[model samples]
Target: MRCDTLLLSAALASVATAGRSLQHVGRKADDSLAAMYNNVARNYASFSGHHDEPLHKRSQHQFLSNKTSSFAVNGTGIPDVDFDVGESYAGNLPITSDPKDPNQLFFWFFPSTNPDASKEIVIWLNGGPGCSSLEGLSQENGPFIWQYGTFLPVKNTWSWNKLSNIVYIEQPVGTGFAVGEPTATSEEDVAQQFLGFWKNFVDTFSLYDYKVYITGESYAGMYCPYIASAMIDENDPKYFNVSGMLMYDPVIGPNDIQGPIPTVAFVDYWTGLFPFNDSFVEDIHARDAKCGYTDYMNKYLSFPPAGPQPFILPGQDSDGVTSDECANIFNDVIYAAILVNPCFDIYQVATTCPLLWDVLGFPGTISYLPEGAEIYFDRADVKKAINAPSNVTWASCSDISVFVNDTDSSLVPSIHALPHVIDTTKNVIIAHGALDMVLLANGTILTIQNMTWGGKMGFQSPPVEPLYVPFHDDPVEGSIAGSGVMGTFHTERGLTYAGVALSGHMVPQYAPGVAYRQLEFLLGRIDSLDSVVPFTTDKNFTEQASEADLGEGNAPQGYASNWTAPASDTTTVKTSPAAKGIELSLASLAGVLLAVFYLA
Candidate 1:
């Protein structure tokens, strides 16, 4: 696979700010990173996932499932449902402010609690690079949501708030309620601002000495590591006590464009799921050999283009589905039948479905929940109790600027250096869901194998899954069933890098129990006197991480420096020489056709 660190670096340039000193980690302003921050301030409703459709589309089952929507009872099997989560706790945080711009101070506060009375705290950031953690706190992973025009409470199975004092901070100046004009010009600038936010967060919350773990997914990958490094770099034993980190399906590096990963792995991933011709994938692999050993993606092996899959456009049902169709499918079929909204509710797109019109702004309509679902952030009951505003607007989509800005700045340097950084750490865990189309797991593996950690050996080898568990629950089988794969990482030195279980890009969102439990195991929060858990093939064995193993005494220093740039035709190396020739021919033919058809 081709890995181009520079391309990733170029993308992050526009929004980057200069890096700040770690000594003032908590004091800087402008840490909030998002495209929505500087160039524009988008309406809230526009931020939620919606297409340009006038009304949302709906599936037959979605309509039927909506018919079964309930506000009276919690769900089919849930008992003693107490829906009363409110803002019993409140706090404020400040960011760097220009004396000239009085109203431009950055930073916002989120309620945190240590349900277990522990000194450990975990900060949760939902990655959009520009998306709001407040939304993540209330709507997606937190404990409540604003409902029916009021604050409401919901429960969470994997609430990090319960185990550790969880803090959700709006970062990168322009993100969430943290308001500031954007002037950042480098990734280092963004890193400095983030460090400033963390320092301020610690000072304001009086948790400067707390054992903290920074965690997130997507673009947050770009933010978390740099911030963590800065925190540790300051060498403030109290403020810099970053024990370890957990990144769930993060976009940490620029492997997508810089590495051969996209070229080699994408073919297998798409073919496995879509109706692409089987020969197409084989042909592509034959053409580009870097797509090494993709047997794990056998499920996606299909024939030529499965007539382009349906596209969900806004305002129209050309595909006969609504704006919220994808989400509805996720909510209704995957989790309990908590309808998030009619397929039309998300995008407000015009649609032929009468239900879209009926449900649009229907009175007494509070937040829609997927069945068998519970609110994590601002629950309906909590909103009512607090008299909070219920009708907050959600953006239909994230500002493209945020992703472009964050990735452009953060991914480049990091991707180039990640292998080295990972090598020295003794633990580097990367996992992906086989079925996830957006961030294909096979692509992750391909990227990893091609990477040379610490410039030494390439991070190669198949993941050894010691245990396998069915992820999703299917009524037909009366048990959880699905291709929920788990990968256990083992270092060449015999240390357990990490174990990743079956989950989508947002692993924590899909199975918090697994995610949190894994974190605890990683951080040695469990009762394990042993400093390390040796890998075992026995099915019943359970392993855990020990603090001693992760402490300063055991942690390694600089990684080896044996990295080598791969050849330009990296994708062609994985196949036999004969296969490679055929692929070149096909690609050449395709290029000629496109040139004649489009350019001519």
Candidate 2:
């Protein structure tokens, strides 16, 4: 099966001391290291010293530390981040009602930049079934990004914070910043525990009846649906008012749906990257025909599914173990691909020779980080700034299992939960990055075709509309660089399928402009992906927003080359007041940074 929860096992433990990080892929850390991390987490200080902080920043942090109360964090800016990060809240909340419970769920909440979507809450989760949502915060569609090869963190002008009050949660227990023991063995347990934590979160902020949108990527596709079903079952708007949902490259059905059935097609589409010999390609193609995968695609992967679907049976397959030799073609291709290209990445198949250094240790398939690079989140100083636990050494994905059993006692999301969620919310987006090989787009389509939602089995017509990103006035990137046909999308019965072009496993990291446009459609700003909405204009700003005309495809030559000193809009950025006594001027500081990004 395709393990979606495979994540950062260890990126920095060895990078600092010329050692190597633990190479545990798809599971928890090795036993000895896990024990050490757990022991340290249980006995560390609430905050740590960051000697490298600037004097002014130190003063600001001091002011924030002096004034502390429940649920208050980041009263100032993050340590080592030169620009204003804006005000935010981060801390662990106990899953149990007891005040002294050690089982805690960690969260980081950032308010919206635009006042219009302030009441709307977007909860973001990352799947590894163990990966930390903080990864989503720092690298995906967050306020800032420390990209794989980038020297310094750069502003993500298309941060989701611009549209809604977004919160990232590391969940199901043994995740990043989470402190607890494994207990459950099913998705049901995962959902109930999450609901308990969510109850605490909403009450803390007094969100009695806010419109909530649940979003995530990878294995989170399985998570978002179940969580949504649980909320809908509650029938309590005050506690679980979910209005919409979105997932990227989700695992809604059996693994084979997104793996074997369409893998050959995927490889064929990107032959430039695989470097397969003609004979090898021909043999694999012959294997495909013998396996019946070719017939499966021809019959089932239709505009409207040809018939009722069940699990895929590869190689004229049966009983999960077919006699046919080509049954293992999917993995066979991977083994061959890796042999040919040592640096091949299944998440993004286009990856080539010379792997890039990553701060998160596991850059691609192996653990790696160049010398002098620090894992930002693991540093005690960073933990203090974010109000994360220091007792346990943090890994992007938990080294210990979150569940008592490796396998879940629940059906895949598509069969039961996802359809219910789609019918209830009436606003759902299931997006997939075109370049993601781990979960092929065609496989996802097959799953969708099999599932029933809104009284329909599958899409009546094919997705044809172009996903457009309008030209904006920016200097460094220029209008042309950011404006164009980002992808394509289609909607039927409240379900939208967006195929993001040139994006890999993580859409936001590879195609921020496309992700931004997707958010615009999800938040009900524009009618659909084809709507010509400017970066900022939405239904909320009727007069000022409507007047801004956006180009359809590309602007005239040199239209973006002409640079002029941009005028500043002294608009105030709205943020929460710091707790206790000393309140930092986060609103003003955030405003200054916002002005520079041309995000007014």
Candidate 3:
């Protein structure tokens, strides 16, 4: 899944973070919690087992038939919280049409709070070829989030489920709570089994004609395209009505191009963060040019397309890989940097000290938890409450490799599948976090520049346009700082490319508000990425309001150099073109974990 995850999704060197603590602005009810987390502490803060949140209840008639009711989950009242979670369904379903098939895939589905939830289903996935999607649910965009350094789980004001039905699946066999022998050896095998699982899952709820939106992060960049392509091939709307697709910091391009090829640009652009000496910096640059990576990037990372790029590195075709020195550039920088700051985090690059205990166990690139901190999903009581199989042990990232030799031959999406998906769906969004060190954002740009879709090679124009986020009353995350210029995005034909400036590999976890806005764009709930509203739907959005939002009082509609908003304004904050000392490790171009495998 993650590189450290056997080199699949996102994996990396262990680093810590220190310095400023995060503050939450909440109502009087959560006043006590506001004081509890003053800063990131070396010691675990004591939290109250008490909760006064309202338990979401089924309104009137049941949404499920008697046959499907068996799958209904107990509104899990965690041992720690007095209130039950929102209405949801979870468990394993046979991956095949045959009920007796030993193969099954695990899933947790939360119907949206909206009345039209039945008409749509948004699928959320994580990248490790074997990473569990529950990580997204518990720590990212799901309704409830338990972030690092927080004393207790709080309701996510920007949870995706607030707008559409959301489903988090633990995919491939042997990942997380998923049971069955890990037999698949390729993405096709992964996709085929997933399709089978999908059929069973929909039938269980008697779902049909539902608009399916495929969304995931990391290696899911790999999983989604293959799956979406398969769904498109199915030609059966009842079962495979994929309306749109979204991926965050995904590995859709060639792993090399997405990682090592752009290593230098990432480093040079964010040069301030790496503690590497000038000699180390000069070494990577020299190696970069000698390896032909420097030429490859300059040639392909341009508009109007560089006439379809091929494996341009010297001896790539003959050797079938880049030179060892070249491949090791990414690993070399990270390794050296971590030496100076063992607390140096590749995922965020902004973190420093005592790693906060993670409920998922795997926080950032390393697996860690404080003493007595039981993983929420692995808790026997939690499993029983959520209709999960108590027999299976769960880990955020799988311990065993999900594939043979850790190899998948399925082509990178940019080569064939991604363009096709973009053409057909005409509603595709590929978003990357600027702060991610595992997959550099510029590398994704290079990939896009080479891709041809909708009769064009790449974006003819750069994304200097500012992406606006409406002001909100979110207490946990609060609103972003500055003018709400959270990120930059561009739409060409059916494809939208977003560069979330302040986020990391996990967009929803690092920049939930920005991720939520992208969701709004993907679902067609908003006409454009730039809209001004605390929260807007077709019912209340206005062109005049949008025009007013772009007035002189707001930051200029361009990059950060022109932006004038303060960094921490409660109503609207700016995050892109990162300010001084606000480091964005230029995307995890070479996933941090790759270092452990190739250079460790």
Candidate 4:
């Protein structure tokens, strides 16, 4: 994948470096998008409508499923399956990072699943500041796999694990697989746990001194860089050889630059979504100088601040619920995704929904209906560690937070006294589904733009350049649709920041192909020419191929190349018990709703 294209001479004409405290790199295009963007604009506009319907509807299948990281521990264990498993591979080595939380850490050692046995290790992170990496493992890359309504496992054609040795860590003490250790309360505390886990992980798996690359998105934007920085500080010249860090749609800085720029950026995003609501923008801007963002955000967005805000799920039709109803809808979607996708697993699994409800401040109303059913994709350890709360679903929030802090201290509380830092040596890519309101990429972009960079030696200097590249070329408009829009100049020297096109904050779940493709491109850039692939000919197909050849001696002796097709569902349902149970429950729910509507 070698390209001899020269830098397009700073795509935009050089700007004057005058009294401006911050150098802004952006296109001065009118807000009215031209023809090239029609498709993307349409996609962006209608993004909320897509999610109302299920993914299975989009794919024209019974339901969407990811095979590699499916959750099926309760009823029957998933069959051991094989795929490229990364070229010259054998078996996967699964181990725990924390001895106390044994099931929290899960890693797939890919010594080049492709025919080429490469030695570079890249860690994959999914962002939520509180989400799971398993989503990335199964949905984006590796062998694709997903569960059908929490029971069966499916396969994915795209798996990053296949390209590199990827470790999916459920972090912090409270996230998926990991038990919320009573000890952690702040970011720094979690940092120590992450380091401890990584140390054990490498030592136990004989990977103490491997070439490491940390990568992730959303809050991971904060997670990846923080983890990399922490690893560098902790490892330095010892345990792990740290190469660099990569972040996608990262939440680095809070967009509170010198002036009201951060304020302006946030307002721009909010207004873009709610075009007519300049009143809020004006009101916030008026006090942005005095009150500040942290205060303003909590008041307006979170509970106890302002009233509830309307939630928008892109690619789905709006149900037009009240503010309270909107909040309920957002909460419901999150709960449904977590609960219904029993095969779906996340950071840490609470014992019951009520426990999760307790965490979120909800009470007895939420049902633990799927009662005895297991969260399929959740780590067994997290399940055991937390005692498995019924009302709550499992996720990797703790891990995400810990990793974010480890990547960089910018997110740490008191550390806020210091200026934000970006590792210029690393290229950060953040992608998301535009339709996803659960975690908006807009917020992510605004976050990155606002971070302050304390210039450091060796790291790329801050405020380097921001480039806007279209995703694809469109002939009629001479522009690309669903491409890039936002970028930050070097926050610290050497760091590269990129935001995905037409994506929500959760890039993998939204645009898996784009995510993996961007990652592959990023790896090429990070490793420099050292990791470049050579063009080869597929003798049988007589086609030219760009395959990375890591040479023959380093290759494994031999690998099992057999592939298996998943078996069809054949379990006969014992309808008598389940039918009677559901029938009564449905009837009860109907009576309640009818009573509420008519009697009221």
lDDT of 1: 0.35
1 or 3: which has the higher TM-score?
3
By lDDT, who's the top model here?
A: 3
Each candidate structure's TM-score, on Cα atoms with residue i matched to residue i, is 0.51, 0.78, 0.82, 0.47
lDDT of each: 0.35, 0.65, 0.68, 0.35
Off by over 4 Å in 2: 1-68, 321-324, 473-481, 537-600
Q: By descending lDDT, how would the candidates be arranged?
A: 3, 2, 1, 4
- List the lowest-lDDT window of 10 residues for candidate 1: 591-600
**TM-score order of candidates, top first:** 3, 2, 1, 4
lDDT (10s digit) by residue, model 1, range 1-600: 111111112212221211222232465556455443432313211222211111222232211132222211222222222453322222223344323432122222223333232456667665544555654454335543222222223455344544445666655555534444554544456666666656655654466577766666555655566666666667785776766565655554333221222333433332322233455445545533322223222321211111221122222257533223222221222111112112221111111122311111211111123233343323445333322234422221123233223334443323443443344333334434333323334444433443445443333332332322222211111111222224343233211233333443455544444554445544454321122332111112233333333422111111112211223222111111111110000001111110000000
List, residue by residue over 45-118, the lDDT tens digit for candidate 3.
Answer: 22221112222344632456776677677665655544455678888987789997877888988886565455
Off by over 4 Å in 3: 1-62, 314-317, 477-483, 537-600
Q: What is the lDDT, from 0 to 100, of the residue 490 in candidate 3? A: 68
lDDT of 2 by residue, 94-118 (tens): 7877757888899988766565565
Flag the better candidate by TM-score, 3 or 4. 3
Per-model root-mean-square deviation over C-alphas = 20.9, 15.3, 8.9, 22.0
